[model samples]
Target: MEKWAFITGASGGIGSAISLMLAQKGYHLYLHYRKGHEEIEKIKVRCEQYGIHVVLIQADLTDLDELQNIGRTISRMPDVLVNNAGLTHYGLFTETRIEDVEQLYQINIRAPFLLAQMFTPSMVRRQFGRIINISSIWGMTGASCEVLYSMTKGALLSFTKALAKELAPSQVTVNAVVPGAIEGKLLQRQFSSEELGLITDEIPMGRLGKPEEVASLVWYLIQEDAAYITGQVISPNGGWYT
Candidate 1:
């Protein structure tokens, strides 16, 4: 059977890597991006080199209407759904406004939860699916300045565990990938060179992780060989906060 995969936030570094990896694996892709058209286009060009069809879906995940409209935008139900789109707020908990909380909740938790609802029925009918939530190590260990981000990611972890059990009977696997200090645009945008340096020093591996490494783990989790690995939170953090 021809496989299809849907990845949210496919314009970003890690998402782009996962998109290319799935494309290389011969899956037709629906790459969702709220912005970063140029970046996403570049990824599409590269992914097409693998001889698979690629579709771009643009929607602001924070908007309920847009999120729901995603169902109508796809050609088919995805065999693999990677909930990788999220927003982060870095500040003291008291400094976080209601607007910040709402955005974080919508993108990080609500969007994924709704996407699961939109796609899981088809997966259940087919008795096969892979749902990978791209959570952060902060979700597990709780970062000081990113409290809201941590809460949302932590919710994803719990969602993964609960949904895995619910979907297990149908052989639809749900899992979370928790990465730490990945060398990506998000890190670059959020931290200074010196801060990143300090973070790297904390990691046992002494370097920020590569996007390809995380993508590789995601690819493995979606494979038939990994069917038994549901309800698991796998962290590829180079021993940071482990």
Candidate 2:
């Protein structure tokens, strides 16, 4: 039987990398993106070269209606679910608005929770599944200005642990991948050149991580050999965080 992997935020750097890797591995993809139509299209075209089915799913995870619609859009339940869509708030906690908090919770917490509810029952029945959450280093160690983002990601870490135990009896696995300072448009947009330089200097490895590096860890966690590795929080931060 063909495998299906559903990845949210499939247009972002890490998301696209995961999608491509899975496609090359022969899994049909359900690629979800809130926007970034052009970028997602490029990923779709590239993945199709692997001769696997690629379905584009667009949904604003903040909206319950749209989020629910994603379940209907996909043809089958995914054997692997990558909760990678995230929104970050980069301001002092005091300066954070209610709207920012809501969006953060919606995207980073609620959507993944609901997606789990929608998909995991099928996984449990099938007796195999991989749930990989793309979390952050800030989620592990709090960040000064990104209080809300950190909280939401920390929630995912907890979710991964709890759900792993819940699904382990059925041979399903849940894990969180915490990444640090990856080189991407999101990081570049949020930090200045000098700030990024300082950030890179703080890492013992002396460089920001590549998207493929993170994707490699994710690729491992979803494999049959990794079935024993559930409820673990693994970080590929280049020695930036323990």
Candidate 3:
């Protein structure tokens, strides 16, 4: 039998890395993105070279209707679901708008919860599944300006723990990958050299993590040997927060 992995944000930093790694592992990919079709199409073409089916779907996760319509667009249900599409907000709490909070929750939390419903039933019937939510270090430690982002990721962490227990009996494993300071263009835009240096100084490893490193952990959790591991909030943060 063949396997399928549906990864939201597959055109992005960590998502694209995960997509490539899973495609290399021989799983057909459903690369989900809201925009960035040009970037996502490149992934589809590259994954196809690995001889696995690669399909692309465009859906704005913040919109519930579009999210619900995702199931109808896919060829079949996915064995692995990577809930990775999210946006980050950086501003003082006092300056944060109510609308920003709602939109953040819509993408980071509610979308994944709804997607679990969309895909889990097939796994329950087949008795196997892997669900990995891409979280953040701020979720664990809570950052100053990123209050809303922290709230969203913290919610994802809790969701992973509770859902793992509910799905474990059905042989479906759920976990969250908490990443810290991964190398991305967005990071450059978010922080200046001094700020980035200060951030790096705090990390014991003295550097940011690579997207491939996070993908490696997700790859391991979905394997047969990892069947026993569930309900974990695993972080690849270079010993930043133990």
Candidate 4:
């Protein structure tokens, strides 16, 4: 049987890149998106060229019940689960709204935990699974005006490490990819070219990491060669956090 991967935030950016990469590697995909049906359809069309089965599931990760329902609806448990759906809130902590904080936590922390819980049993039974949580550089090193987002990601990092140990004996690997500033709609909206250049210059590599770069690392971590590696937070941040 073809291995299957479940990728949240599969509509664009890093998530979309990872989906395409995995499809080329011959993995069937279950893509989860919040509100980008048009974009998802485009990805589905592209994925068909690779001759991989593409399934689209639209559910806001903030709603844990909906996520569980989606999980149950899928025909088979995924061989790999990429928890890439997350929301970011920027502003002084004092100015951030409680509702926004809650929403961020819901998507970043709660949803991943619940989805993992729902799907992991089947993986354990099969003795084969890969869980990759797409975290952030801020999650490792806290960022100003991004306190809540950092907290949730930090929690995810901790979850990755702890769960990796728990599932290792079952041949399941859990890890996180901590990415630096990538060229994407989200980063462009937050920083001007000048500001982005300054940020990039601060990195040892003097360049923003690309989404495809991160996806490549994820691709490696899910392979059979990576079986011995688990419970690790691997940062591909262009030497930004060293």
Candidate 5:
């Protein structure tokens, strides 16, 4: 039987890259996207070309009830769960509204936590599972004007570490992937042409990291060979942070 991977926010950026990589590896995919049905359809078609079963689901992860429903809908408990759905809010902390902060917490931290809580029991029963959370360098070294976003990701990093310990005895590994300034829509939106160029020059690699690069590490970490590794915040940040 083919192993299954359930990835939230699988429509674009890093999530899409991870899906394609896993498809190439013959993993059936349960792709969860909040919106962008058209883009997800494109992803579905591409995965089908690889002869992988792809199930696309649309649900806002901010809602706990929806997340539970998502857990119930999958045919089998996932062999791998990639909690990649997250949002970024930039601005001075004082200007950020209470509602925005709550939104960030709900989507980035609460949603992943609830989803893991709901699905991990079945994984424990199976005695084999991989939980991969797509965190960020901001979570590790805080970013100015990105305080709320950093807080949520920091919480996820903590969650990954704590959950890894709890699930270690069950042969389940939980880890976080911290990517720094990847070349994505998110990064593009955050930097102007000159600013982005300067940022790239600052990295030891002299360029922004690619989404595929991040996905490749995720692919490796979920493999049987990585069973002994857990509670690790693996950073693929192009030497952005030591």
Candidate 6:
């Protein structure tokens, strides 16, 4: 039997890692991206070398109508759905505008909820499925300057817990991955060299985690070995937040 997985933000760092890792596991991938066809094109080529099928799904996740279009292009219902698309705003709560807050929620929290509504029915009918949401440490412990991002991610964590219970009876499992100080553009863009050093030093591992490490966890959850695990907010934070 073949397994299909749909992943949003597939052109980006973490999403690409997850897509490639799943391809190596022999899962057909539907890689979703919001912008720039070129990035996913590279990833698609990489996945194909593993001899697995990879499809590209493009959607402006903030647009509800566009998000609905994602599943229509792909013929099969995915056995796995990874909601990895999100936006974050870092600043004083008072300095942030109302619109940015709304946008953050739309991408981080709303899109996942909408995608679940679209995909979960077939999953329940099939009696097997896996859903993994890429969450952050800020979601678990609120960040001082990133108040808006924290709120939406916190809601995602709550959403994972509640939905896991509802879907588990049908053999569908939902989980979230909480990552910390991941080596990515976001960290580079957000912090200075000295700041990054301070952050890395604080981590017990003394380094940033590779996106592949995060991808591996998502791979593990879909296996029969992890069937007993659901509704859990598992962190791959290198003991940073434990």
Candidate 4, residues 1-242, lDDT tens digits: the string is 78999999999799999999999999999999999999999998888799999999999777767877996789988999999988888899899888998899899999889888878998999999999999998999999999999999999999999999999999999999999888798899889999998998999988888889989999999999999999899999888887
Cα displacement (Å) at residue 237, model 2: 0.1
| Cα-based TM-score, every candidate | 0.99, 0.99, 0.98, 0.98, 0.98, 0.98
Q: What do the candidate models score in CA lDDT, each in turn?
A: 0.95, 0.95, 0.94, 0.91, 0.91, 0.92
Worst ten in a row by lDDT for model 3:
180-189
Clashing pairs in 5: none
Error of 2 at 224 (Å): 0.7
lDDT: worst 10-residue window of model 6: 65-74
What is the per-residue lDDT of model 5 for residues 121-146, given as tens digits with 9 covering 90 to 100?
A: 98899899999999989999999999
Pitting candidate 5 against candidate 6, the one with the higher lDDT is 6
Model 5 ranges with Cα > 4 A deviation = none
Tens-digit lDDT string for candidate 2 (1-242): 99999999999999999999999999999999987999999999999999999999989999999998888877799999999999988898999999999999999999999999899999999999999999999999999988999999999999999999999999999999999999999998998999999999999999999999988999999999898999999999999998
Misplaced by over 4 Å in model 4 are: none
Give the Å error, residue 61, model 1: 0.5
Cα deviation of 178 in candidate 1 (Å)?
A: 0.3
Where in model 1 is the C-alpha error above 4 Å?
none
Determine which window of 10 residues in candidate 1 has minimal summed lDDT.
179-188
| Model 2 stretches astray by more than 4 angstroms | none
The number of clashing residue pairs in model 3 is 0
How many clashes (backbone N, Cα, C below 3 Å) per candidate? Answer: 0, 0, 0, 0, 0, 0
